[model samples]
Target chain A: MSTPALDATLAPAAGAADAATPGTARARTTAGLRGWAVRLGSLAVVVALWQWLTATDARVGLRFDRLPSPTEVAAEFGRQLGTGVYYLDLAQSMIRILTGFALAAVAGIALGVLVARSRWIGDLLLPPIEVVRPIPAIALVPIAILVFPTDEQGIVFITFAAAFFPIMVSTRHAVRALPTLWEDAVRTMGGGRAHVLWNVVLPGTLPGVFGGLSVGMGVAWICVISAEMISGEFGVGYRTWHAYTVVDYPAVLVGMASIGVLGWVTSASIELLGRRLTRWLPRGEGSAR
Target chain B: MSAPAAEAARVDAGLAIRLEGVSLGYGPHAVLDDLNLDIAPGEILVIVGPSGSGKSTVLRAIAGLLTPRAGRVLAEGVPVTGPSPDRAMVFQDDALLPWRTVRRNVELPLRIRGVPKRERRTAAESWIARVGLAGCEDRLPRELSGGMRQRVQLARSLAGTPRAVLMDEPFGALDAQTRGEMQRLLLDVLRDTLATVVFVTHDVDEALLLADRVVVLGRGGIGCVLSVPDPRTPDIDRAGLRARIIEEL
Candidate 1:
């Protein structure tokens, strides 16, 4: 690897990096690729084992034989991809989740900031929130049903309930954790309370708020599907439950697969957005490892 | 003769600060009792003391971040009810806004004071350059070393041209090598602004190196005030002065 040249050589950076040092930028990229390969390989192995167990009708510790085989589920997935109802269900579930999440995020942040800022607001608001926070969002399903006129609104409310607390709690903690020195610095600059809120409080709480957002998003997904199973008419969870009643195991598996894929995509986006917003955070040592 | 009178003997273009019977404590933990002190305009007054001696408490009182339980803290002939643009503070920790770039952090005071955007940029950039961070204005606070961050902070404190700069151990966190560089940098920058500086530190050497007058405070109250003959002049025989300050502490 003595074939090194300066950055002035204009050689491709990847090749130069690979040649210069073994554990630098190029090594990290290769390591990342290897990580992805391992993950995919592990997933494939799980699928293969499941197929073998179901195909052979093995009466193991668990009831693997009763479940649809991988090929049957794959074929069901292919059929679902061709249908308009499947697409409609996918879009419906997505819309409800997004609307609820957006509403929760807005309210959570405003209330979180308010509660963190003033003792009066904290005392006035915190008691009710604290009492309500202990109960799971899924438990709100019964209340959501009686309060809303439609199943759609009921499910959406449950989703909103699921997401709200994590965002609010995280944002509150973040605001509280801010060093008093930053506030002192701003105040000494002739800045009033509004100035500190705008300049210091808002941007400083972003990382914490994002942490709450990520957690809220995951919880929202969990409860939204559960609410759909209980009260929904058109979304994926309802459709999946509908398949299970008729004993179409392959369609049920397909529905589960769709939910898994959707959950992964949404959570990944939230995490990616968090990283983008907090680019200033030190990416800590040996992150690749 | 009193040190403040000697220090205030030559004054110009800076804020005159006088603490009249300033007694401060949080309820039962009485920090200072009827502490009467005067800091002359354009004077570099260094307050030296041990931990818990209320060295920082005094600076906070002047910056108006903390309210005095008793008496008045007057700046520029006006009572300091709260923090103002005339009295900016530099904290020991890099209080540079983590999210903003070096230039943006420096521009903050101007922005707060409602200065025009164009003027804010010019002032911020000049200060950033003056602090020898010319090409790194776009970098975030976390990206810079501790010394560089303090330099940014120094630039930030001096920006917007405040009448008085209240520094609470602004260089206390830096390494010895960086501390010396920052001291030199502060003196070089101090020449440009006539802001009355009330600096707080525990280091005896630091107190004599930068102060026209030094105030030593203890758990009870101010121990003594020393007037230096030509502050920051390296050739002066400051051994007696240093010995006196150490003895008082």
Candidate 2:
């Protein structure tokens, strides 16, 4: 039904060749494969350069004599996967992270709601927390060691400190940003303060709370690993530092890789849980991927 | 007109609302000054005016969602201090809980009243059906159209069978056709109920169509009170009255 002029206007621009083609399933698959190929190719090039640098002693002016080649690190990774000690270290790190993160989640949300909802509570509580919040978890090492009886508890405290602020700050903003009409509607329906909290405040603030949780999970991993490296006797972080001290460069790389994988998995899990809880929300255009 | 019109606005003992010398302001800015009005039980009183005329503020005062700087707002015989279950409000924006399904949102007032689960669910279902949302019970507010969401809000407000209903531009966002349909639907639904309604709108036609009496509010207080003669059939030239209201504004 289009006229010649309309057809001309509808035609794709000359430089937009990709846009001219329909975005069918096969096209999507090809695009996905291309993305993977590029990523794998970049990784392979890095590995080859690393292998070349350490294959012999004379490849470059800058020499890393203690650096382990990719092959040696891969071999050590396989051996570590076979050992019970490796599993124990991984489990220890997980236990500390989960325990600390759980404590932070509960306390953070409680404090956030209290501060946001009541002026008296905000005045009484916020000052000390604001002072404590700016200090980094790494900076708290000496004080934590002195306060806690064991290194394990000190590491857990560091992890908790890392996560607590993000969750608390985000939840406070979430509660404050709620539409007044929602509370008004509840109150006019004979709902008391408790009912308003249950029906309006809690559910309304969940998306922001989950955003905090995701960021907190990533930060928790960093704090726990750093704490373990400096003070702990048995964790992935401790194992990594111990390997470096003993000059087992391949083992150190293995430990680093383990920590990286663990952090990625935990952060992904938090995001997945957030998505499940907030299925009613329409996916924003910016969050398409 | 600056003085409180309390004596002239006095109503009988069975009046639904009485605003006596009510003055409201925000910081240094006054919104309503010495505003006096009254509504009898089972009447549809519409407050219509231009933007910034404090129409919605008056509704909020009656609903006890906002406190006035001076004077009293009495509902039945009780002086308004805070929101009560007997005075439900339909907000301009559909304030249905985004996480809750349509049925659950409508069931909220009953839940607050401590009605048992089975009874509240049944009551909510009946009201949803009355509002033409029976099949969409499980749909969240985000999934529904704006008109549909407004219907859910209306159903939620009426579910409690409140003694008074305060509405602030409840259908101001709907398309013209949908707005007309909703106005008709409101009348149909409230035909048998004896609830007093204080509906606020900028739409003169909507006021003439719905109100037993229309209170035209100016910058700070009442301009005039015009009776519709018969809301269902205005008998007078509706356009002429609309023009008169436009002039007053």
Residue pairs whose backbone atoms clash in candidate 2 = none
Cα shift from native, residue B123, model 2 (Å) = 1.7
Candidate 2 C-alpha lDDT tens digits along A1-289: 1123222432333224355555554465477568768978999999998887777653356875558888999999999999999999999999999999999999889899999999999999999999998998778999999999999999999999999999999999999998998999999998999999999999889999999888888899999999999998899999999999999999999999999999987887787778667766766532321
Which window of ten consecutive residues has the lowest lDDT sum in model 1 chain B? B3-12
lDDT of 2 at B94: 56
lDDT of 2 by residue, B149-215 (tens): 9999999998987888899999999999999989988999888577888999999989999999999
The lDDT for every candidate, in the order shown, is 0.88, 0.87
For candidate 2 chain B, which ten residues in a row score worst on lDDT?
A: B6-15
lDDT of 1: 0.88
Could you tell me how far off, in angstroms, the CA of residue B212 lies in candidate 1 after the best superposition? 1.2
